[model samples]
Target: MSRIQCPRCQRPQSHCLCPLIPCLDSRTRVLLLQHPSEVNHALNTARLAALGLNNAELIVGEVFEDLPRLLNQPGYRARLLFPADDAQPIQTYGASDEPLLLVVPDGTWRKARKILHLNPLLAALPRVTLADGGVSRYRLRKAPGPGALSTVEAIVQALQVLEAPVSFEPLLRPFEALIEGQIAAMGEETFRRNHAGK
Candidate 1:
């Protein structure tokens, strides 16, 4: 039989990561546009990110029919959190400046691009990229390249940058625990052989 899972975090009851998840608040709202394929993946980091933040939402689909309404959050300017040649670096905001509605595409590089391809309005938003040198802690998958990060890690880094002096580290606790759990399940020898160095 399948193991019982927590309704919230989706991990099996014995290994539920809800306790480690935080409900941190952020000035910058996060909107995770996840591809359907990622919803059932073992490491659904985008779901974790959505749960950890008070100002976040996770929507799973390819073509978002309500794109206009979704991006029309008041008192915030929406920006796509994807790297591009013309993408602007996310920066700390002043007290009086309007905060960002950070719309992130949660999927593999190709899937994320496909989401953009299907939703032109989402793709047309002002783009924002994280600063360089961030690395992925997600060991089970081969990263697309250096500086690649899991969805949660990218959100953490982006929040840290946009809300300077405020730490988003708490949001990473559940993610870290999840990684450890995955590594343990796979056995140290296997992890060392396959994912440790990359």
Candidate 2:
């Protein structure tokens, strides 16, 4: 039989991550647009991000029919957190500037692109990207390229930049714990042989 799982974190009860998830506030709002396929993945990092931050929401689907409502929060400008040649690098904000409603697409690169294709409004948002050289902490899957980060990692990095002077490190606690749990289950020898050197 399948192990009983926590309704919130979706981890088996024994491994529930609820306790480690933070309830921190942020000046910038985060909206995670997740592809349906990622919901059941072992390390659902997007879910972790949603749970940790006070001003965050996660909506999973192929095409979001409510794009306008989702993007229209007052006092914030919606910006896609995806990379592009002309994408602006996210930076710390000043009191005079409006805060950002950071809309993040969460999935494999191909799936994420599909979401953008299906949601035209999401595609049209001004794009902002994390600086080059931010590394991925996800060990199980090989990153498609350098500077690739899991959803939660990307959110943490973006928040670190957009709200500098406020530490977002607490947001990473459950993510680190999840990675350790995955490594433990796979056996040290197997991890070393396959993923350690990457």
Q: What is the TM-score of each candidate against the true structure?
A: 0.98, 0.99
**Tens-digit lDDT track for model 1 on 1-198?**
899999999989999999899989999989999999999999999999999999999999999999999999999999999999999998999879899999999999999999999999998999999989988878788888877999999999999999989999999999989899999999999999998887
Query: Would you list the C-alpha lDDT of every candidate in the order shown?
Result: 0.94, 0.95
lDDT of 1 at 91: 91
- Cα deviation of 194 in candidate 1 (Å)? 1.1
Error of 1 at 11 (Å): 0.9
Candidate 2 Cα misplacement greater than 4 A, ranges: none
Q: How many clashes would you count in candidate 2? A: 0
Which lDDT tens digits does candidate 2 get at residues 1-198? 999999999999999999999999999999999999999999999999999999999999999999999999999999999998889999999879899999999999999999999999999999999999988888888999999999999999999988899999999999999999999999999999999978
- Ten-residue stretch with the least lDDT total in model 2: 134-143
How displaced is residue 74 in candidate 1, in Å?
Answer: 0.7
